[model samples]
Target chain A: MELFAYPFMLRALAGALIIGLAAPALGIYLVQRRLSLIGDGIGHVALTGVGVGLLTNNSPVLTAVVVATIGAVGVELIRERGRTSGDLALALLFYGGIAGGVVLVGLSDDKGNSNLMQYLFGSLITTSPQDIVVIGGLAAAVLAAMLLLRPALFALCNDEEYARVSGLPVRTLNILLAVTTAVTVTIAMRTVGLLLVSALMVVPVAAAQQVTRGFRTTMAAAMLIGLASAGLGVVVSAEADTAPGATTVLMALVAFLGATIGGMIRRNLRRRHNRPPVTTEPPDVVLHG
Target chain B: MSMSVVEVRHLAAGYDGREILRDVSLSVSPGDVVAVLGANGSGKSTLIRTILGLVPLSRGEIELFGTPQPRFRQWARIGYVPQRLGAGSGVPATVGEVVASGRLARRGIFRLPGAADRTAVREALTDVGLLDRINDPVATLSGGQQQRTLIARALAGKPDLLVLDEPNAGVDAASQEAFAAALTRFAGNGGTIVLVLHELGPLRPLIGRTVVVHDGRIAHEGPPPEPAGHHAEPDHDHVHPHADEVKAGICEWAPTEGAKSY
Candidate 1:
């Protein structure tokens, strides 16, 4: 009751809820593309964006949106060019992003030390009216973009080569995914911070995948898990005096573990009851690049 | 000869300038089930991908349905199935939805699927004999059924030209037969096919012509080779050494005194 009494708490809760819904919705495509770590990659890259904003006396959140979008594009390019290099390309971008941020913040000013910590740890007390507006606008945009591009995006996610042959603009759609992921992380950082935002994007999705067979169902399940985790974490952190971002991410992990165990139990029961096979026969694995 | 479905002249293509396809030239006419045969890495896949504009050609001309590659836009006229449908192809959607997506180029993205689109999807599934499994997630399908789903997806588009890269690769025998039947039905309706293949398998009878690719060049372009006795057993999955020699027999059959157009 005391927590709801404050306007700032209300704003923070609102912001967290928006991100909770938006992250996993956007995450559906990324996970399908096998670019799950891209959220963290963009999250780390946004640090440099934040540092640049502080130095330029501009809005750090806005700067994060810009820099991370470009960084997401960079990851897409590297991914395209370095398919043979495997995770080496992703590793380079991930480390380069965080290391670049640390050096930039270190050189900007001594006062930037706390701004750095605030971005990394997520200072819930600092949720301003302006933050809520930006978060809301971006969340709505992300959601609508996903809806409009659903068919084309689904084709690309299902198979890039097939999509290309089908005449979908493969490169443009890949860029669209990168841009949305960037914005997803920027808005998500408002609630979950830079470090744990990736977990918010992916963990709920992992859990959703365990129980759902269809893509739409998996996406809906993930969004629900994300909202539940985010809402509960915010409330729990308020009462327990814990870090909101870390707590929310931890809750998502708990849900994933629960889903995994529950899935295992169901599989065993199916075996005992002699039900039809859950999935199709052994997937015919093919090796072609 | 009726303005051939696909025409490639002196097409040279490769990844990163390594040149996997060297001065390759081929043409497919309507209602022709032309099989592009090759050993692994011999550029058969590259040749088909080049025609579809998936691969860039460095120094040649590719005209799809008479429109040059770059200026061509009616992608709905062509249906393509690549060599691999690897485990849900990395995303799992329902069979009907997956088949419906084949209509994207035809129906466009902004509007919802129409009655025609639905009919196309249903008929495609029926053609593949997977109409009953339309609501199931593609992941819940067996290997053969999944390939059938992909075939249904291609069929739903109702393309005049169908380009498949190794339709039989890594798929179960049941799927291979289903795919062959679907192709047969498509051919009956006047669809032209350009297939990339290693072994003809059950599809041997459908192939009207065979073009063999070797070391980035067209080794043979003529009558489908004899059903190498090696594969006569139906159960032998491996291409035996004698069969390889028979497939490679094109070299001696060349008309120009071993000038390489075997």
Candidate 2:
């Protein structure tokens, strides 16, 4: 109860709750499309944006949103063109982004490496009022788009060619999804940190899928799982003196393990209960002349 | 005379820069079951893809329901069942959910699904004998069941022309029979169909016409070819000879200017 006593903890919890719900909501589509690592790629790109902001003495989150969005579009375009494999292109963008961040940050005279650490591993305690406001607005937009575009996005991710022949704007929607992913990455940076942000996007979905039979249920369960992992992880870390981002990700992994075991047990029980009556009989083979 | 349901003229299309199909022209009327037969890499899939606008034509035009492909916006009037399940194997989607997505074009993207959408989904599943497994994840279904789910997905749209790409490829005999039954019902309702098939199998009775693609050209178009006695085995691999090299040679004559002439 006293965990919410501190103003910074309260801010951290608020940011956590927003990202907890938004990341998995958008993440289910990425998981469906088999692009789970894309969030990590965008996260790497957001680091360069942070460096840009520090160098220009501007807000890092804003710059990160812009830079990461461009990176996301570039990656999506390359993947769409099919000239190169998706992972290969992401690797190129990933290395380029991190190296660019290091060079740009080294050139700046600000608080140097320590500031980047806050973005990389998350500094939930240092979340400013401005950070919360921006994160809230962007997260709300992401959630709204995910809800409004659920059918289209599901169809696109489910069967792109079918979606195309069905007269959906496949390319435009692809670009929009890429942009939405970019926004989600930047919005989650302060809460989960750039390095660990993708964990929130992916692990909960994996966990939820272990027990859920449908996409909608999986998405809903994933969000609830994500919310618990983030909110409770923050509280537990604050009490135990651990990193909130790492704690949150670890909690998600624990949930995934639990779900997997539970699912296995449930399947076993169902199989036993519904087992068909076996009939042992001699083979009646038909011989041809 | 009723307008042709589908009219493809001089369609030349391929992947990358290579021409896979050249001078492919076909027409289908309402209540017709046209089977497109060909060998692997013989451009049968490419032809279907070109008709669906999944592949860009190097030359020629495609008209669906009398409307040019670029201008044709009535997608709900045409249903499609791709060769394989398009959704990746990793994602979890119920049979009902995937079939429900087929109604998206009818309802538009912004609006939520109404009672009509739900009813269509249920009926489609029932048509495929998958109503019992509506809540089950598609991943749990066998290959045949998955293909049936795709058929149901297309049927839920209630299209006038159902286009299927190898609907029975790798499917079990029972699933094929189920698919044939569904197609028979669709045809009974006056639905037109254009399908790409490797082997006629149970569908031979339903195919009113056959168009054979050999080396990217329509080598034969008429009544279905009577498979020789040796090739009469069920599920036999069908391969037509490449003796049509002369025809292929003629098609390559103006390859350089193929796109410009369109």
Candidate 3:
């Protein structure tokens, strides 16, 4: 009750909830499209944005959104040029953004800034009401975008070539996905930090997919799992005196493992149940032999 | 006579810089069942791809249903079934979902599927004899079942012309026969068909006309002469003896001369 009374805790909880809802919703499409690593890449881009914002004395969240969005578009453009796969392009963008951030941080005059560690490992206790508002608005935007682009996303996931032939604007959808991914990564950065945000975005959705057969069901399951992990991580962090971001990511990973094991057990049970009945008749000719 | 449903004149097509089809000209009329026969690497797939506006036409023109191919907006009138339905095709869809995809071109973006679309999907599944397994995962189905599902997907749009690329590849004899029957029914209902086939042993009887492509050109364009009255339906179901062993038999019958018009 005391923890709930604190404004910081309230802000942290709200931010985590928004990220938990939006990241997995966007991640469902990424997982289906086989570009799950893009989440990680965008997270690094957000880190770069944070570094730039800190140096310029600007709003880190705003800078994170802008930088990550540009990074997303850049990755998409590279993929469109047929130079690299989405995963590979994301990898290049991710490492480049991280390296740039490192250089920018080194050049900064504020060498003993404690905020740097907060950006790296995440800090739930430091979230302000403004941060919560930004995360909430971003989450709403992401959810709206996903709802509007569901059909196009479905077509793209099934077959891009077929989608083109079917009169879909594949390039536009690609750009949209990239943009939404950027927004998701930026918002998610506050929960798991830049280093491990992708885990929150991808793992829960992946685990949900193992159990759900349909696209809508999978998305719903992923959101549920993400929310559960985020809430559990917050409580555990408060109780154990650990870092909230790392604890959230670790909790998500544990959920994924649990889901995977449960899926395997269910599959094994189904196989056993579906097995054909064994014959009871003995080989009569063996006695004569 | 009315304009041909599909017209390709002096069309040249290829992937990258390597040309596989050169100076290919052909016109397909409505209700025509044209079999494109060729040895491997003989540009059959390229021709189909070119017609579908997938492969870029380097030279010449293509017209569909009296209009220039570029202006052919009636995609709902055309259906296509690719060579193979691999599990990795990223379709990870149910039979019903796969069939529903056929109506995508008909239903523009942002419009949810209505009752008519659902009826068409169900009818298509029924046409392919897969209504019982409409909810089954496509990956769990056998090769024949998967092929049937693809056919159902193409049929769901109720297209006037269906282009099938190697529909019978790797299928069992019974399934091949069943597929042939389905194609015959489709053509009998006045739908045009252009098929690319490597083995013409079983399908030879059902095809109305044959065009052999070789070295980026039509080597022969005429009615097939061997197995007289080949289009007649067979009475016996003997499992198509020597079907697998007849690969050598087909290679021996390859055209020895350049293309000759019928």
* Native contacts conserved, per model: 0.46, 0.56, 0.11
Question: In model 2, which runs have C-alpha deviations exceeding 4 angstroms?
Answer: A83-86, A274-289, B226-262
lDDT (tens digit, per residue) of candidate 2 on B141-252 = 6566778889999999899999999988766555677789999999989999999999998899899999999998999999887778868889777665753663344333
Per-residue CA lDDT of model 3 for A91-165, tens digit only, reads 778888988877676566654446677776677778888888888988999988786666667767766666665
Q: How many residue pairs clash in model 1? A: 0
Q: TM-score winner among the candidates?
A: 2
Report the C-alpha lDDT of model 2 over A179-285, residue by residue, as the tens digit: 99999999899888999989999999999988887888998999999999999889999999999999999999999999989987876776679764221111122
In model 3, pairs of residues that clash are B219-B259
Query: What TM-score does each of the candidates earn?
Result: 0.89, 0.91, 0.85
Q: Compare candidates 2 and 3 on lDDT and give the better one.
A: 2
Q: Look at candidate 1 and give me any clashing residue pairs.
A: none
Tell me how each candidate scores on DockQ against the true complex.
0.27, 0.29, 0.15
RMSD in order of candidates = 8.4, 9.3, 8.7
- Alpha-carbon runs more than 4 Å astray in model 1: A85-90, A107-112, A276-289, B86-91, B227-262
Model 3 root mean square deviation, Cα atoms? 8.7
* Model 1: DockQ score: 0.27
**Model 1: what TM-score?**
0.89
